[model samples]
Target: MGEKDKAYVEIYDTTLRDGTQAEDVNLSVEDKIQVALKLDELGIDYIEGGWPGSNPKDVQFFREIRNYHLGWAKIAAFGSTHMAKYRAEEDPNLRALIEAQTPVITIFGKTWDVHVRDALRITLERNLELIRDSLAYLRPHAERLFYDAEHFFDGFKANSDYALATLKKAIEGGADCLVLCDTNGGTLPQEIAEIIKEVRSRLGKDISLGIHAHNDSDTAVANSLMAVSVGARHVQGTINGFGERCGNANLCSIIPGLVLKMGFKCKAGEPERLRRLTEVSRFVFEIANLPHNKYLPYVGRSAFAHKGGVHVSAVSRNPETYEHIRPELVGNSQRILISDLAGKSNVLYKARQFGISLSAEDPVVKEIVVRLKERENEGYQYEAAEASFELLMRRIVEGRKETFGFFDLISFRVLDVKRLEDERSLVEATVRLKVRGEEEHTAAVGNGPVNALDNAVRKALLAFYPELADMELEDYKVRVLAGEPGTAAKVRVLIQSKDGEDRWGTVGVSHDIIEASWQALVDAIIYKLLKSRRKRLEAA
Candidate 1:
């Protein structure tokens, strides 16, 4: 499409407000401020901070945000239309919106007749007045006023005339944009497209339209995209599809879709910035304390992961054969999962990923392949434990191996004792280490054997490397190998460790659970120390 014919869609992020509605998703005022800054950095057009009338946290959020400078995003304060019992000027919600002092104010009002009568217990005419008065009152205070027609799709389906009447009232009240909301999230893409087409025809070509969709039907992203395809110029979504019920539309997926697939320009439309979609998506997930959904589209870990032999072989020859879009387009890399179904090409590709100089014809490559298969058979999954696999590959490839010795471990002992008199069990660990030919012995007690072991090791090494204090174990997971002796199954342990700047995962497998955990813990500490040493050397 030519520049003259190009469509520009404004991307509005509601992660702090709508996203917090998702179960188990909560953000502090500081968190809200951080996310708003990140959205601004990502070139988002608008950020709906929160509803100031709903809670004191949101009110404080508005106050806190006044201190920061948002380069591109206009912060929006969200609320509902005036209550039926109060005048727009007297409404607490409207007063709170004004207090927020944002450039944009968005207020959602009931458009469905059922919601108007059943929820609000007000006449249809009264609801229309509420919509009009609320926007009219805020019109002078805000640079842009948006009226979200709540339950719009269902309202239009049930009573098209009433829904259109509500929109007309909002327009007459001087709303800058009319947002059509799939509040129930049950509308399909085809239905949304047709309804939007009808709305555009009735509302006229000059009227700006926005879409707000939920994911209860698992089509929120699809519905939003469909609305844009039809004529909606503004798209409202939360980061990672977070909201009440299923979620709102996912901006991570929608941004790339609108820009790359639909030829629309959004703030995130620039190719270079758009490539950071994965980083941004993961950052939001991290802030939410939610695990990243590996199966998510565009920015997921497994989006470009190939597991099957034929798929890996073909992707190796030409990524275009199995991949739809280039992985680099979204700042994600192609991952070749090693499994029983993997071929020699998978091993070769993996070797290259580690920067190990090995050829398809090299005997060591075959050796590595056999080693992977044999270890996998014994319950080692390199795909989920890439750190262990990388160390293994380094160990197998002679002369290319890196040294793992930062400190030498002399011995360790763990003691677990339960006393009837105490009514509580006790665990203690002692670790002996040698650094620069000097030996240090340290002992510590902890809630569990692993904790004691971690304490003892760190206690012994803290003098030699004080920065180790910054590194702590974040997560520890244990999975027993399936089809093995149930009670005697060999357990695989994965430990994730993080310093202030970076996180790394290490793995170990053994029949003894404690031993496996110890191996992983040791590897975690080693990885951290090695990384720190490298940074120091680079600085020097």
Candidate 2:
């Protein structure tokens, strides 16, 4: 069907504004611009750039984004209603919104009497004036003017008359759309449906309505969908639910829900654009330097992963037996996890993924399954550390044991010294390894024993393998196993490493923290070297 023929819903992404409000999510101006372009490519209707009045970085973002032309997405500048003390034209916040020069300007105002009295410390009638005047003053400057009735749901519940009055004020000021915000994210789906129905009734069906929901109650996506089910045409959310406290509604889940299940079409819901969902989700996470939530619906890695022997057997036969939607629909792929619960079918699946030609009847496949179970029993989780699992399989396949042909660890020592006069400890490490029958020795100093060891090992190997210079340790995580033992408990280290092109994870477990780190680090280095070797051979 043509896009014009479908029932359309507008997708307003607040990722740049609301998503950055997430703890530990800080995007530079360049990052924001890049993310804006990505959202444009994904076909979002509006991209809330940021609150230009709030900070210099956001203001700078507004100035910088002007240079780039978006495909179809409109840039939006967000701010609250003008302060009660000042006229709309005199208010610096409103002036900043005008200065932003965005085609769309979204201004939020107090919707509840309690906020007017308690938060704004103004008379309810005066708060209405602020809402009306703010939008009226800016209405002419904005191609599309939107009024976000902040805390609209809570306001409606507290005093239905006051909340409806706020909408009326926004309409008086010429708001193109009245966005009902579940600011606290406490409303349920049924409540959303009922409230929106009441709103449509009072405001008349001709008014344009939008839903901006938060996920504090973990129902943002549900509430958004319900609002749509009841006639809201605009949805406001962040990708992957990134927002303050809990999160905003996740556009990642909401878009697919509207397109596939709810039969509503959006620019992002087009089949071709929908396929970029996973990539955009990961890109935002990457730009923020946050780990991806693999459990996120539709766009997460584990979303379509089948692990259990029975489940894998069933999914291999018919994906619909387990999956709700095809993983490819959101640009995610089916992952077969290798664990103690894995059977030969899991092994065969993984073997094919790794480009290994192993038949179901191969004795080696059973050997790999048994060996994987044994390793997992020792606190080695291959699911997050696929490089280690691949190495294990390759070792077994090549009839070798323990280590690969790239290099072997001979011995390593770390010394940490602290003096009363010195504020911090100094750590040094010496590493000796055998590479292609020759022994290489190196020593290095670092902030910690693990870092010192990493430096020393790389220092020793760099002379022989210059490609190792391109590899960097992206993240390192340590999990204490058997915590009852406390200080003496075994620890599992998962090391994430990346070179110029790809990233891989490796794992190791040991009673000693440094030893576990070393094991994972070694696996990471070996994986990189092996990948480089494979690429070189393929080119030849």
Q: What lDDT does candidate 2 reach at residue 355?
A: 86
lDDT of 1 by residue, 1-540 (tens): 665147889999999999999999988786677678778878899999999999999999999999877788899999999988899999999999999999999999998999998999999999999999999999999999999999999999999999999999999899999999999999999999999999989889789999999999999999999999888999999988999999999999999898878888987878867876876787676556455698999888789889899999999889999888887787676778874333356566567776778887888877787787787667665443456667778778854323365678788899999979757789999998887679999999998889999999999888888989999886666777656678788987777677788556677789988888888888788767767876899999
Which lDDT tens digits does candidate 2 get at residues 394-511? 8899876465677788899999999867578989999988988999989999979888999999898898899999899877767777555779888888777887786777888999
Which residue runs of candidate 1 sit more than 4 Å off their true CA positions?
2-5, 339-540
Task: Pick out the ten consecutive residues of candidate 1 with the lowest summed lDDT.
Answer: 339-348
- The per-residue C-alpha lDDT of model 1 at residue 372 equals 77
Candidate 2: regions farther than 4 A off: 1-5, 8-79, 85-107, 123-147, 157-178, 201-208, 215-219, 236-256, 265-404, 481-485, 492-508, 530-540
TM-score of each: 0.69, 0.68
